[model samples]
Each structure stands twice: as C-alpha cells, then as structure tokens.
Target: MATGADRTAFGPMVIVAADQHEARPLIDDPWARRLLPASGRLAAALTKYRPIRRALIAPTEKKIPGLWASMLCRKRYVDDALRAALDEGGIEAVVILGAGFDTRACRLPALAKIPVYEVDLPANIDRKRTALTKALGRVPANLTQVPVDFNTENLADALARHGYLPGRTFFVWEAVTQYLTEDGVRRTFDFLATAAAGSRLVFTFVRKDFLDGTRLYGAEAAYTEFVRKRPLWRFGLAPDRVEAFLAEYGWHEREQAGPEEFTARYLRPAGRDLPVSEIERSVLAEFTG
Candidate 1:
C-alpha cells in the first residue's frame, strides 16, 4: 500500500479543486469542467480522473460529508490573504513549499512576470508536470518545479539551482506544517531566515485545541479522518503562541487569524455560500533576516 509521501501526495489534488471552487470561477465552466481531464486549468482537472476520484476523494468525503466543502472554502480564505500579503511585499519571486499541484502561479495574473518555484516531493512533482503537460500541452514558462524531499533535502540548495534569489521573495507554506516533524518545520524556518530581509511567509498551522478535543466542528469525524490519514498531524501551536514562536525564528507576525475571521473577511463580504468551521488558523509573517 502507498504510505508516507506517496499517500500524502494525493491530498493536494483535493486542495487544488477546493481552491478553484472557492476562488474565482472561470468565465463559463461547470464544476466538472473546472476540475477534469486537464492540467494548469484548475483543481477540477484531477477530479476528472475516475481512479483518483474513487480512490482518494470518495473515502475522505464519505468520512466527513461537508469537510470537502469546508476545505475548499478554507483555501479560498487563506489564498486570498496570501495573495494580498505577497503583493503588498512586491512578489519579485514566489516559492511554494510543499506545493501539491497548486495552480496559483498560473491562476494569478500578477505573477505572470514574476518567476515561480514550486518545491515538492519528487513523485508529486512528476505527477503534476505530467498532468499539466497533458492539460496545457506544455508547462507554463513562468513556473519552475523543483522536486525535493523536504525531510532530507536542503530547500536552499534545491532553489538555488533554479535561480532562486533569497531577497524579498513571497512564500506560500499552506497546509504543510502539521505533516512535518518539529525539526522539519524548524529547518524551513531556518531557510526562511537565510532569505533577504522583507521576505514574507504565509502558512497554516493546526490549532492546539483541535488535538485536545477542545475544538473541532464535527469533532468525531474530523479526528477520525485525521487519524486514518497516512501522514498524521504531528505539530500545532496554541493560537496565542504563534507570534512569540515565529519571533524566535526571526519572523515578525504581520497577521494572524482564525477560520471564523477568514470566513467573515473573505467569504461573507463576497456573498459566497461556502462555510468553514474555524479550526485551523493561518499566519502571515515576514523574515527579519
């Protein structure tokens, strides 16, 4: 059976679809059209495949019926916030760590002129490239995929080969932290500290309460599914502890928000129907180094 990175790889495809669903829709596209039989289009492309649809997605949603919708809305909220943060900092370079078929580099027009480096497990990178190539007939010029195993590789060395400049780069580290060991998470922060000043990070972390049974909307379902998943949640910080924690790593907190805050901020004001139980919180911080 596929365990570890192999199993974890499929998680992002779902995230990508949720992303397309919650974010701006295409000019005239159905949900299935948004997702299927194409790459570089939207997350919907992955959904088009029968094997993946049945194997990876079916079981997860079955475990928690509305969880898929919530995940999508969660992406909607976080991505919107990350875009604003990066834009404000001037996205000279974009590096998506643990990038799992995320199409942000192509989806956001402002990034067209900017170079994008997507770092992920090699297996997933190969899969993404193949799918995207099939979808677009070729990979987009602005996007560069740097395949690396975050557990063993030096992010700096890998990015350096791709012409990554540490200065003022915008980083997206969403939905990645909890899967990493504490050491692994620190290694990433260590790399960020090495980047040019004004470098910013946008990331999500599991909240402490969720693990303690103190929070979790569909508590039983959420906990059960997480346990069932191959890459289990290994780390989370108390909501109040994030700023101080990042400060120790030379990251100055710019924004910290819970799911409720994001829903009200990103969804409700826009008249979106997606509802997210404010479980995980996203934080935006800048590198002091």
Candidate 2:
C-alpha cells in the first residue's frame, strides 16, 4: 500500500464534484479543480456534463453510499465555522493538522491575513507545495507548510519549531482521526489541551461501531476497503461519548452534526436528495483552558 501521502489524492477528488455541482454547491473551492492530477483534472472537466457526471458518480455512490455528499456537507460546515470564528476576531492563527489537498488557505480571503500552517507528512507537504505552485503560480505568502510524521513526532514541539504561538487559534482536523492510532489521537489532544483559552477545533471522525465492524451503516464496501481488507483506519470515537472525550482534553463540544443535520443544513437547501453516511460526523469544539 502507498503511504499516507497517497491518500491525499482523495481529498481533492471528493471536493471537485461539489465545486462543479449543477445547483447551489454546498462548498465552493475552484482551487480544488486546479489542484488535481492530470487524470483527475480530465475527470473533473468531464463532470461539467450532467449525464457524464451521473454515470461516473453512480457506481462510486452505490459502493460507498453518500460518501461524496457527506463530504460536501462536512466541508460546508467547517468552512462556515472557520469564517464565523475569524469574523469574531482574536483568532491568532490557523493550524490544519493532516491537511491534505485542502485549499482553504489559498482560496479563502479571510485566511490571507492570518498565519496559517498546513501540517502533514513530509511527502504530502512536498506534494502540496508542487500542487499549489502549479495551481496558483505561487503559494500565498501567509501560508506555511510544516512536515511531521505523527507516529514519531510531537505535535506541539513541531508547531512550536515552525513559529506557532499558543493563543486563541482555530484548528481543523478533517477526515484524519480514523487513520491514526488511539495513542496518536490522544497525544494530539494532549497538545490541544495546552492551548490558550478559547481555541476552537473542528474535526471529523467515524463512529466506533462502524470501525469495529459492528455496524456497516450502509457503507459495507468502504468498511471492507478501509477496515477489513487493508486496515487503513485505526481508531474511532463513539458518537455519544464525543463530548466527554473532548472534555478530557480541556475542550467543550460546541456542535456535533451528523447525517440528519447535514441533510437539513446543506443537502436539502441545495436541492440534493443524496443520502449521507451515518458512520462519519463532524464536531466543532472550543478549548476551555
């Protein structure tokens, strides 16, 4: 299997469809189209045709069942939360852990004035730099790419080395927890626990039941691929216990949105009838310090 860097490809792939959606898109990031590989760019271009789009998406949806739609909803939710926090002021910095092909730093105008760090595996960071250069002619001046291997490195120390100061900050940990070990996840929280008062964190996680093979949640194919077959995913947090879990790290859940809420907030408004997977959900939390 390829390393974690290889998995970053999926991030751009998921958002490109939403970027090209016919109706009101849940999220808008034209940078997603620019960040893709040649074949992906071709596929993205083909999606401009409705019939071709449906035919291409139908099989993936049948196998993963709402994976694409749910991703779009989560992206929308996180983007809104980040913007709201930024507008509230006092946000000193933005740290995106496991930041893959995410384009927020380059595309979002609000982020242009803030110190933004994108932390990922070294290989992925290199890939991101190349993609950003290719897509935007040059990376934005406000962004910094930090490379760290979570399994062996200390999160706090690495960021500190990169000029990260502990203050009111916003952290994004999207689509990352499940791929990490339980200890890895806890160690990251240990770092978060030390953040200054009022730091915000937004993250996505798979349900423990789904991870353990107890409940497939209509995503049997995905479960088989990422869990049973290759075992790419390593950790899960029980939904009901997420708040208590965050509390252990000095964070309080502000909002935890699942499929039903996503459908109501994003899909329905956009006139999309796609089902959202119940296995994965997003949590927005604030550090109590």
lDDT: worst 10-residue window of model 2: 1-10
lDDT of 1 at 104: 72
Residue 181 lDDT in candidate 2? 85
lDDT score, residue 265, model 1? Answer: 70
TM-score of each candidate structure, all chains considered together: 0.79, 0.95
Query: Model 1: per-residue lDDT, tens digit, 1-289?
Result: 1226445655544444534444443111232232233442444565456565445455655554444545555556556756786567665888889877676765677778788899988877887787667667888899999988766779899999988876678888877787777888888888888877788788888877876667665656767656444436767889899998998888898888665675667556666555455556778788885
Off by over 4 Å in 1: 1-5, 8-66, 85-89, 212-216, 228-231
Error of 1 at 233 (Å): 1.6
lDDT of 2: 0.84
State each model's CA lDDT, in order: 0.68, 0.84
Residue 163 in model 2: lDDT = 92
What lDDT would candidate 1 get against the real structure?
Answer: 0.68
The top-ranked prediction according to lDDT is 2
Residue-level lDDT tens digits of model 2 in 169-207: 999998888888898899999999999898899999989
Q: Candidate 1 clashing pairs?
A: 35-44, 35-45, 36-44
